[model samples]
Target: MARETWGTRIGFILAAVGSAIGLGNIWRFPFQVSQEGGAAFMVMYLAFIILIGFPAMLAEFVVGRKTELNTVGAIRDFAGGYWQYLGGLFVFIGFVILSYYSVIGGWVLRYILGSVTGGYAATESAAAYFGMVATGTDTLIAHAVFMLLVIGIVALGIQQGIELGVKVMVPAILAIFGILAVYAFTLPGAGEAYAYYLSPDIGYIMQNWQSLVPAAAGQGFFTLSLGMGVMITYASYLGDDKNLGIDGISIVVLNTSVSILTGLVVFPILFSAGVDPATSGPGAIFVSIAEAVLDLPFGRVVGLLFFLTVAIAALSSAISLIEVVVSYAIDEFGMDRVKATVIAGVAIFILGVPVTMNTVFINLYDILAAQILLVLGGVLLMVLVSWLHAGEAIEELEQGIGDLGSIGSLWIWMVRVPVILVLLVSLYLGVTGYIDFLTGAFAEYLGTL
Candidate 1:
């Protein structure tokens, strides 16, 4: 069977953007901004996305379009002997990420139902309501349902399944987000929320660079869907003569736009309700928004739209993560697409059991996959593409756009020196910071008990 290619250029772009915009942007970004000095985190995140994230994205595109293969095949074919193991690590990263990611996908699904029925609206405390539903039986059922949805889509192959799905999903996501943003801006505290989200605190960043930089860097990688084979796998479906650079910039811009838009929707609501944004972590969206919406006009209708948008966004991204590993199975082993998808989905669902059973495992897997492993993957892949296969990478990059000249040299330089150095530093800080974070969290939990 011939390898599946994207049906159209726009299809590919939407799908790639869909992959980049996910729960990381919608759920995690707001909390991260609140915790990491608000606008200081925003500044650093945008810098990393433009400076480090773009070049790394192009590098992944080069490898994928050059080989027209999954990450494992791309690395193995380009750099023979022992290098394929590196490719396997990326696939593993995707699997691990999706394992926990689907659990959150489950949460989004539950919230969607909660929005429809006003189930959470009757609760005295949104935090307590979230605590009740975030784990155990309800979450396990939600996780299974979400994982099954992902499997059904991927099993249909690229053009029919992933491409067709994202084409509809991405647009709906953008439209709903736009509606929500406009409504949020009309809130009384919108100006204050904007100041909190957009105003920079340089001193806070300087004082807390150790934790902030790594967290921002990790958020950059996580939100952009970098440091995993998702981009590589998405690009593998591309036809020739496509400009990887321009497409990459488009993805980055759209992804960042949505991240900012999510803040527009979230922060205004929180500030208007006089809720503290920093107090909520993973459940920030649920608790803060749930509480805020109860006091707003047509709050249930707005809540439904918001959670509906989140559901679509989560599905779009989950499709890409599963595709990374499913493509590997089909490409390397010549397994049938449907079979590969089912097997991959089942394995990921099983892996997600612990995450659904205990919410603590959610933080554990998130830090392990998003913060630590992702930055580590970025470091290794950057070195592999920019250093090990410099000539081939440049040649592939220059295909759609003629003769990069100074541009090509600069990209390699960015990837080699600063990108690698920054990721390595982030990885180190992430490891130590996560340790302290975990320790403190544990002691705090014990004290409460």
Candidate 2:
């Protein structure tokens, strides 16, 4: 079967960026930067992006473009039977990720409605708001509804599913975020938030070096939708005419900018409301930022805008993840888009059952995603690009990027050696207990009592 292709280069870039600029950027970056020390981590993270993330991304791109294959096929062609399983593994992880991911997107959708109805405005307490979000049967139902919307979009095929979806969603996400940041900066404690985010803390950096290094790198790769087959899948539709390196750099810049901007908005609200940085947990934005919103001079408008923007950002990524599974299914198996989407949706809904039933599922998912899928996937990609298609990779990277092409050699080395070592070290830290895995504040509060 001939593979489907994206109609326009811009469409492909937008779709790829949609997958990259997601919950990782907005949902996690704030709490992470707040705990890890802001600008220090950001600086290291940018270095990782250029040194490791960009190269891994191009590795995925070359495999996709040369083979015109999805994650599964791309691996099979290069590495034969042994490695193809790894690629299938990536596709499966993307599927597993989308399931629970959309559930969080459901939280965003719920909050968007809450904002419109002023439900969030009446709440004074973070715990109460977070409680209202969780432990409610309604939340699960909302997740189901959100999943169906994602399925519907994926059923539309590329031009409609990914292309048009991102086109509208990306602009909306940026516009709302820009407005929210402006309003946030005007808040009384806004400068404090900026300091909290921008000021370097060498003590924190040194103490958390082992733990934070892996995290920053993982997020750098994950934030840009690299390491996973999502980038490979998106770039398969990429034409040889455009400069892949330039396009990759643009996406990385845009994704990183949004992540930083989200931190600018979130931490200020957090600092302004005097929320405990250590305790914000997985739902920190909802808790800390929600509390921050209620304290604003125009609290209603601010909270409404904040939650709605999060919803849009979350939805855009969810749609792209769904499309990754949907596209591979239709193209590889010769199924119709609708049949592919429905099966993919149903399978994911079942997989997400763990996320709904177990609180530990969230941690398990995050840990496994980083250690197993993300690290392993990235390592495999580097090997394929540098070892398997070394010559072609050099040529493709040089084609569009001009003088910048020379850095391509260094990128390959970093992605192949340093990147894997860092990921392995981080995975070991989690497994061996070099540091405690403290994600929320409840434990500290409990200790006080």
Model 1 global lDDT (CA atoms, 0 to 1): 0.89
- CA deviation > 4 Å runs, candidate 2: 398-408, 430-449
lDDT of 1 by residue, 253-294 (tens): 999999999999999988998989887467777888888888
How does model 1 score by TM-score? 0.97
Candidate 2 residue pairs that clash:
279-441
**lDDT (Cα, 0-100) at 42 in candidate 1:** 92
Question: Which candidate tops lDDT?
Answer: 1
* lDDT score of residue 360 within candidate 1: 80
Q: Estimate the overall C-alpha local distance difference test score of candidate 2.
A: 0.74
